[model samples]
Target: MASSVLPTPLLKDELDIVIPTIRNLDFLEMWRPFFQPYHLIIIQDGDPSKKINVPEGFDYELYNRNDINRILGPKASCISFKDSACRCFGFMVSKKKYIYTIDDDCFVAKDPSGKEINALQQHIKNLLSPSTPYFFNTLYDPYAEGADFVRGYPFSLREGAPTAVSHGLWLNIPDYDAPTQLVKPMERNTRYVDAVLTIPKGTLFPMCGMNLAFDRELIGPAMYFGLMGDGQPIGRYDDMWAGWCTKVICDHLGLGVKTGLPYIWHSKASNPFVNLKKEYKGIFWQEDLIPFFQAVSLPKDCTTVQKCYIELSKQFKEKFGKVDDYFNKLGDAMVTWIEAWDELNPSAAAALPNGPAK
Candidate 1:
């Protein structure tokens, strides 16, 4: 690792980096120093008795799962899929101008050539710098073929080739599903150009939670990570499913989704069998669920995100009325999640800035 110090955030007191973890704060001990002058919210999901060590002068807050369940009440309990599901808790509680969601195992990539480039600093810079209303990561797939699009690349834009997607390069480990690895192994030591590719109006892609940043205003509408995680109906797909819903909601509101830049080094290894087993439920439901998102009815002149979600809940109830209750729970959770956001982030409500330009 390069001996680079954490860079001061441009947003200062206005940014909150939300991470969900069930482990100790060892990663923070090593990298928290880099995210100075910003608030860090750690969602300690399990073993709440084990205290997290917070070094002096670090602006941070730690919340256990029980604490969040108490705060959000029973309606929000179904949303807690696993440790990563804690992201929704962080989202509702966040009162900052921007919310950055990253995994505990993820870290900034060192410049492969041993130069003095800090990827985390670049991510913060890119995130803060005015570009689009939303950004979907366009990082290179280590397992992708020449000119091949990533797995969730929209079929709508596949033929027409839009340019709003940005490409990010990761150094060490890559974030891919287990099945992808079984087909072909990830190559080591790869660098990619940081290009922001434009996404057409109807395009959608699988958004990764490991490294995602979004404007705080979208929190109410976009913070719907549904029933997933260990011991739940499914383990993975909470973030990706939420991403699809968010992209649809964003499109309805005329929000731009940009993909690319500020590459991250994922320090974890892929386990195909375990991941494949966990992915079964989500994969089975996605084929039907995604089409529903694309075709769902929404008022063209939708005034508020809340109204849009009302239609969404109704649609969800209508579509999946019998198969299972996940959709209904999701629908109810969406409304409650917004309410929780309003209740928890009253100051944010007071700051009521106008939505970003469509």
Candidate 2:
């Protein structure tokens, strides 16, 4: 049930909203105004037996655990159930060129001016614009209105790299690590920073999947959330894992990852004790993981995202196998994810861009 009114000239027509949820989607009521027009790909995580209702008028297709098994078949082994990581399944099935993913708990945030912020609108703009990741711009996003690259900024890199990932910020409850959340339970985010900057080349930022958007053709194959520990319900490391791998691949492939701006109101804070237990290993391994990504160097032959990811998986197995047997399995799962991705998206795989993120 779409409105007769045409969408604005923004990147609406080509985009799809992908939400991964276990609970009812009543949170969508607040987003009805902004989300009503776009087609939704709801990846219902957790028990498929449990019914989750969708508000009327939205053009959406809901997929539960049973649907995932039916669609993906044996290749579904690569998909993580009972985890937010399952949202990557929506990315795989999507036929659209652009995808905007938001958490079910996230609500529409207001700017300091009390204006209701349209997060999707800003994400599209970020994706559509060029990102200057190769060189730092002291003046801030030069592509933004009323800003320009300052003196001594290299002219060769000014054209910027094609943005593959657009990472959005959060308001209200900040996305803190388990340790931080455990230490400070009363902390709430109140400041709203209005800026978008490219994650510099060779720099790895912790990517939160909550309010994220990406070009399907460019970096979709590399967007696997993860295949954590043989279907065991793992911790909050899924997006971080994807982010690290995607950043490494993007840096090698000469692409940009942008962040900041288009903040969302993150309402719910999960149990810190639960998060700490799940992310305890993640907290320990994170220190070592950052350096691994920073040191990652892909071969020139690894042109495609799939190839680069496969190489990355090998690196994990080779370097981190002795630390824990899990890396070896995670490495294989990465390859399996690519195989599944190619099986699902044949055309995109066959014609995968080797030159640029476009």
- Per-residue CA lDDT of candidate 1, range 1-358, in tens? 9969865557777768788887766665556546656788988876767787766667888888668778778655644745487677887787776677778777666554655445445555544433333333254321122334557756454332111112244556666666776676665546655454434456667877787766666534565676666556666687786777666666676554545566667777757788888787777888888888878767665445555666777787788767777667666766676667667776654544224223
Worst 10 residues of 1 by lDDT: 158-167
What C-alpha lDDT does candidate 1 achieve relative to the native structure? 0.63
Give lDDT for model 2.
0.88
lDDT, candidate 2, 1-358, per-residue tens: 9799864746657888999998889999999989888899999988899999998888999999899899889888788887899999999999999999999999999999999999998888888889998889987788987888999999998898888999999998999988899788999999888889998888999999999999888899899988653355357899999999999888888888999989999999998887877788888888898899999888888889998999999988899989877777678889988998998889877884555432
Off by over 4 Å in 1: 1-8, 54-57, 116-121, 124-169, 185-189, 346-358
TM-score of 1: 0.79
The candidate maximizing TM-score is 2
What's each prediction's TM-score? 0.79, 0.95
Query: In model 2, which runs have C-alpha deviations exceeding 4 angstroms?
Result: 1-9, 356-358
